[model samples]
Target: MKKIEVFVEKANDGTYWGSTQNLPGGVSSYGNSFDELKQNLKAAFKDYLEVGRKLNENWVQEIEQLTEFEYQLDIASFFKLLPIKISAIAEKTGINPSLMRQYASGKANVSEKRAREIEKAIHELGEDLLSVSF
Candidate 1:
């Protein structure tokens, strides 16, 4: 099965929007929440791929094999789904608690570099946890 990466973000209007990175042009979809967004995105992908296959029948196998999709959530939405406290994560990531809260609340934007740093810290913590034999 082929994997397509989808990036999801929460819009200011309190709606979730998503788009695929590998697909050509600018195809997008929107919904009220993450679960809704997933359903809508799948429908959008089907519609988008159908248009392409209509022009070229060679894309049949590709469309059929395209069963897996991976979603990357934006910082605010990620924090919304995360079960940890901002203060706890701030300590783990070495980020300021207030700043982390602001980012989590969508009151402040987290830069790509800072977001990477935070994610890296979380991954490293996961690796450490995995190393515990007990």
Candidate 2:
């Protein structure tokens, strides 16, 4: 089974929302938290599948085979959920702290390359944490 690509964002009200890219209409869902968001997305996609099967839509075949949702977050939402200090991560990654703050707060657009850099830094941190003795 393939994974459904879901773009997630945190709303002004602090609720989480996500949507599956490309469909007859659009498979979108919202929740107050990440767990709720996944639950709602599953429900919404199930509804989408039923409708797609009924209408005999071509996209349904590929979509219905998907059992996993790959949720990618915008920078702001990522920081909000992860609770990691943007400045610290920026310093570690050699990305300007001010620019990182802007990206974290959704005040600036982050390029794909920049996003990958940030992700790499976080993953390296995770690896460092794994080396802890206890």
Q: What is the lDDT of candidate 1?
A: 0.80
Measured against the true structure, the TM-scores of the candidates, in listed sequence, are 0.71, 0.83
For all predictions, the C-alpha RMSD in Å is: 3.7, 2.4
lDDT of 2 by residue, 88-123 (tens): 899988999999999999899999999999989988
Residue 59, model 2, lDDT: 87
5-93 per-residue lDDT for model 1 (tens digits):
88888777878888888766546898988889889888988888787778776655665577888888867887775566778778988
lDDT of all predictions, in order shown?
Answer: 0.80, 0.88
Instruction: lDDT for model 2, please.
Output: 0.88
Model 2's TM-score against the true structure: 0.83
The segments of candidate 1 whose C-alpha lies over 4 angstroms from its true place after superposition are 57-64, 81-83, 106-111, 122-134
Q: Mark the 10 consecutive residues where model 2 has the least summed lDDT.
A: 19-28
